[model samples]
Target: MTTAPLVRRAHDRGIAVLTLDSPHNRNALSAALIADLTDALDAAERDEAVRAVLLTHTGSTFCAGADLKADGIGKGPGLLVGLIRRIATLAKPVVAKADGHARAGGLGLLAACDIAVASDAATFAFTESRLGLAPSVISLPVLDRVDPRAAGRYFLTGERFDTAEAVRIGLVTAWDEALDGILAGLRAASPQGLAESKAVATRSLREALDSGAEELVRQSARLFTSAEAAEGMRAFVERRDPSWAL
Candidate 1:
């Protein structure tokens, strides 16, 4: 039997809810999923009825970061960067309903959203440093959203943090038990007003990401193909510590 699609989208009460449905890989940033998400966002942008968007996921893990085991990692930086930038600059207001953990590049997705409502139980981390790589492309959005000192600490240490810390560091807008109120508030906005307001609010971020994306993508590609990152990926598959950890 054929597998289900990686992302599922539904529309209700002027809100377009796009869910990451690939629990098998914990919603990893595989090429297929990125493409599907882009399509969903594009459709939502074109739909006049979709005044807002809620970005959520199905599994306990919101996203486990890049699917390094998959063949797409070599070319994933561009796709992932594009998707994140799309979310950041999308005309409609996008809210992340983060009910689970987000790590590494996954944190970039959360940061890209205009508003993020995470559950108290949810967690976050920037785990790229642990893998002998840097969060280069993701830094565009992450840095814009997070506190500079906090970003530096987490980026360098690859430390895991809880929802409270995530909120404190500006990784999420707020922590809510349920997303109903947030969605309701967003859905109540006038479509044109919301769109124009969002455009104004995100101007600086959009310009920064657009100008820096090419360089960040090149850096990501270089690191992903580096000898240290290769060893890190190999060790991850072998269930052993990377050489740098020794």
Candidate 2:
């Protein structure tokens, strides 16, 4: 059987919309997907006509998180960490159009974008703790976007939260039925203006991510190799709850 490319790119009116298309795995952040996303982002950045970038997905679930069962499980977290950093530092304005659920690492991807517009039906969660892992690498972006108090609650509990709650906590900018207007507005800006503006806006976030990425990636790698996380991942693939689940 032939599988489709994980990430798809489309350009319209100076906007480069990158869609995560691996719905078979809920657009999971596998190595292949991560590489494709990185390449797409680079292509958009180099395109003189591309004024803005839209990060979205094709499936009902935006992203289910890392491909834990993939052959390169240990490297998934680090690659995701790099991807989020790239999105945050991208010269063009990047918007996340989340039309579906985004969980665990998916939330990190959403948070790293310059703006996130989610649908009313969209849901989000941290979900790492439930797997006996931590949102270590992802925290670089997640912590900056969400309110500290809400971050504390969600980070520890890994509970699924609704779109309204996600907006209130700053996980997303707003819930909108259509994103064409936003994209149009973004397209109106000059490439130089957008680049300068985004550079100034995300300077702190870029610095923070760069400074903490090494440690966070190490923590993530360590957690993924731990006995607890091993058991949790095994249970997940086996279609059962984690051992720590009540």
- Model number with the top lDDT: 2
> Residues 33-128, candidate 1, lDDT per residue (tens digit)?
888899999999999889898889998988888886675467788888888878877889888888888988898888888988888768898988
Q: Which ranges of candidate 2 are over 4 A from the true structure?
A: 1-3
Distance from true position, residue 10, model 2, in Å? 1.3
Tell me each candidate's TM-score.
0.95, 0.94
Q: Once model 2 is optimally superposed onto the true structure by TM-score, how far is the C-alpha of residue 238 displaced, in angstroms?
A: 3.2
Q: What is the C-alpha RMSD of each candidate to the true structure, in Å?
A: 1.5, 1.7
Q: Tens digit of lDDT per residue, candidate 2, span 28-142?
A: 8899999999999999999998999988899799988888667456677778888988898789999999889999988889889999999877999888888889998888888
Which 10 successive residues of model 1 have the least lDDT summed?
66-75
Give the RMSD in angstroms, all C-alphas superposed, for model 1: 1.5
After aligning candidate 2 to the native by TM-score, how far in Å is the CA of 205 from where it should be?
1.3
Quote model 2's TM-score.
0.94
